[model samples]
Target: MWTNIQAKRPVWLAGAAIALAALAAYHNSFGGPFLFDDEQSILHNPSIRSFSTALTPPGGFGFTVSGRPLLNLSLALNYAVSGTEVWSYHALNLLIHVLAGLTLFGLVRRTLALPVLAGRFAGQELPAAFVIALLWTLHPLQTESVTYLIQRAESLMGLFYLLTLYGFVRAATAASARGWQVATVAACALGMACKEVMVTAPVVAVLYDRTFLAGSFRAAWERRRGLHAGLFATWLPLAWLVATAGGDRGGTFVLTPEAFAGYWLTQFEAVARYLQLALWPSPLVFEYGVTPVTAWTQVLPYAVPVVAAAGATLWALRFRPVAGFLGAAFFLILAPTSLLPGITQTIVEHRMYLPLAAVIALVAGAVMAALGRRVWPVLLVLALVAGGLTARRNADYQDEFRLWQDTVTKRPTSAKAQNNLGRVHFLRGELPEARQRYELAVSLDPGSAQTRYNLGLVLDATGQPEAAIAQYAEAVRILPYFAQARLRTASALLRLGRPAEAVAPAVEATRLLVEPAEAYFTLGQAQAMLGRPAEAAESYRAAVKHDPAQAEARLNLGIMLAQAGELAGAREQLGEAARLRPQLPEAHANLGIVLAESGRLPEAVASFQRALELRPDYAAAHYNLGNTLLRLGRVEEARGHFTAAVKAAPDFEAAREMLERLR
Candidate 1:
């Protein structure tokens, strides 16, 4: 018993070390702000803002499919605990990554300790597995998936993916494997909910059984036919998810021959690039610019090396089945994204979150096999270097400015990166820098409607309305469905006093489902400018109805209603606006005017006084208060207010007339 306890010490110590190292490497990333997709998928995604909504299928929160319900649910859980604080989300992502790493350690150790590989691994299984897990955990290539908040979709799925495999391995070797088998199936199902990549988990499980447990596919199938069936059946949910989800699958089976060849060639290059990054792990970028191969000549250079690598992997399957398993698992996990035709992105580093496990495992196995029992020091050095690189990479994600700057530096032609970096500068009010980045982005990707729209925004802000209108029109021409661009175009046209021209785009803007409130508000502005009061009033009403928290919309709607002689409706809206934004003197003054119109003298006086208190120099509030007081028969008070109004606004003709009438 004493010897057995002593023998287990190194494993426990190594496990603890891996956890600590992972934490230390990612410590700077705990406060990193959300970047890129995080805005749409986590922050602005209302479905994940509440537990009930998150658990239910996304109704209209812009999440087209409820397929990633589990990922959404985890984000909701994080929100509940942190309420939009960046720290908690990053903490959860790190925790998931650590757990996945620990699971990888267990799975590798168990696989190497099996009877078939046991003699070969001898006493090195524990340390070998520890090194693989530690190195993989600290690998800089993993920072994108782990430190980037939205990519929890990848890391969380990876955790469950590894858990399913680890549980299956334990079950295959355990005295009673039934419970473990059930847990494995459950884990696979959970992984499916996290991401579609998990569809490969069952197939990998089958391969693992063949390589380590049963020694042959036929014997494994015979022994665990029911288990195999159950594992395969887990794909049913994933299939249903893909079928029901709104995803970009257009490039799959329908790609034209030219397009297919182009995409296929691009994928080979992408895979080669991924492997290079995995080995070196320097200058990891958030986005890469991939140009499709339009001609055979464009693909030939990449094709030879890619084919040779694939051939080597296949040869390993015939001669060295274990290495073959790792190679096959790597390809299988990547096949969905790489071989699949429709994905817009040619390569994404986070896609390697699971595939990297196989790479690290194979490398560690090779090192251990060559060095025998003397690989510890070399492994330690690799871990320290990887950990240092990971920590530095994590530092890049500490802020959007750093992250996007790094992306632009690494992939200068990535138009999206340039556009996003421009947005960061725009948010910080660095207009010239923002303009420079936006211009660069547009030049790099002339057809990108988003970059055009962003450029239009900066141009409009700098008072170049004509130039801004031109950019906006180009954006609308490039993507007719871009409702925001249409609205911006209308706004710029209105600024240029072209209300009639603005009307068409403003009306078109109202047809979109996204940000209907803003669309309606823009439509109302255009209609009002066209001197169509009734239509303007209706559009303003629609704007307020869609987004009641829109104080400006409510104020505008109330004023329009008052002009349309709907004084009672105007008072209600104006009062709500005042309540929503008490700091706005305009809200209080407008509410007062509506109250006085409806014959509520006391409420009108109080509203005007509140407006004046917020802004003592408010000439309109003072003039309105005087009229309300005179109507209430408070002659002395009315006279005093009228005099003050006239004094405050010496050029106020309306106040002068009211004061003379009072005297």
Candidate 2:
């Protein structure tokens, strides 16, 4: 019934349907808050703060944008336009998805219309391609790439990947193939910049050439050697980016033979799980984590079938090239992430972003072949169902709390999920809930430094300084470069008044943290607590050097300077502290002491008055004001302040002595 209607429709109409379906599926996702990697890649990424450094993403941080300069630059564009509003990022993600869908539609339609397969698809290419594109775009499994924000690295690369193939198909068929070939290379290069997954694109392009255009690899290479060369050349930039990005994509890659073997052994189950989700799309997890199946017995059941399918794909390359291309493309697209051991993530749905295309194409072709003219209604129903599921999945991403909660519910054993959920609770000020979650996460993954640090935060917030320090110490012991943990350990020690213990961690924190002002300030406090005035003053000076606006550090520096007989330096720091924190009475009181010692009696009186104005009952300020007044020969005023000082502090022996002498 609908075959007749679909046959009458042009490709643009089909594209419009795909676009509308994508929009409907993700309309609720525009308001979705940034989650997980988004915080590092988008929110805190200084590289995205300016266009000048857009191509030079922050490295050594394992950020999502670390090695993907194009992804980082794209985020910079979003940052320039909207800062951290998040809606702009989501909008760009949807645009990339829609563009990818349209590209897929064009690629499929044109591929079907090729002379080789035209006899079978004939007039139904538009509808068949539309079904594939629409279903793939609306698949609930894609919510991770579309709705999770930072995973734009996946969808953006997927777009360029499709364009590369689409452009190649056009180049093969066009009368003047030069422009299409260049566009194909450009797309491939851009894809490489988007993600390492694009390394498979060049291989996939060659495979497509062999399957559809050229009869064999030798013929395809001979005919389009230049195009293939250009495609492979793009790998140079990708290689350089990866190498310069700490050669490990920010420590995600684990290249040891044992790690590789374990990760590879786990891929059989991961691939099976991906296929299951592609078919069922239920209980989609945000993060599967980096747990590897070291024992072959655990994955043996999946390994047998997966190995068989791989062997069958190899065999089919000679006899059934088209079927082999689809199978190989799926496996090849997944091979980089699957074969390479990424210590950060093992099984993620977003890794299936492009590979899902091959799966859909295979399934759609089989369904179309089976149902023929009756396939239109079935495809339409599937598209609607997929769209509804996608929308429902996107709802889980509306807030970090909901997303992590959903992930924890689905993957109860995932320590990463529990940690992220605890982070959400921590941010919301739900200390008890956050503490419970963090404790569970720590117990689940005792070796996770990040979880340990997070548990420390919850412990510290709940007033358990010793426990917090223990967790922080464990975190730094595990990941020595963890600057924040080092700083937190020192802070917790200082909280317990263990200045000697705090000094070493505080000093290490100063060396490890990028912004070490807080560490230096904490170190100054520790030094002052231990009666090391000179060292304390130097630390405070270093803190002020890093952050000139730190009022507390300035106040501490002033006190140290005054005690060390640097009256002029003390006065300057105290004045700046008062300016920086006008509401702080301590700043004014310290400045008064420095001024009095500097022989500026009038200024000292005014400073004491300012301190008393901010805090009328400040005992120290009253006593200091009394001393300054007495020096200025204002005996009655001095007597009144001495009385007020004694009232503010009944145990003020110095004020009582002065009062008695005055009497």
TM-score of each: 0.91, 0.88
State the lDDT of candidate 1 residue by residue for 270-304, as single tens digits: 78777778888866879875565667786777777
C-alpha RMSD values across all candidates: 3.2, 4.3
Model 2 CA deviation exceeding 4 Å by range: 1-9, 294-297, 527-618, 621-648, 652-663
Strongest candidate by TM-score:
1
Q: Identify the leading candidate in terms of lDDT.
A: 2
lDDT of each: 0.84, 0.89
TM-score of 2: 0.88
> Residues 222-336, candidate 2, lDDT per residue (tens digit)?
9999999999999999999888888887667778998888788778888888888888998799987666685768898988778887897899888888878998998999999
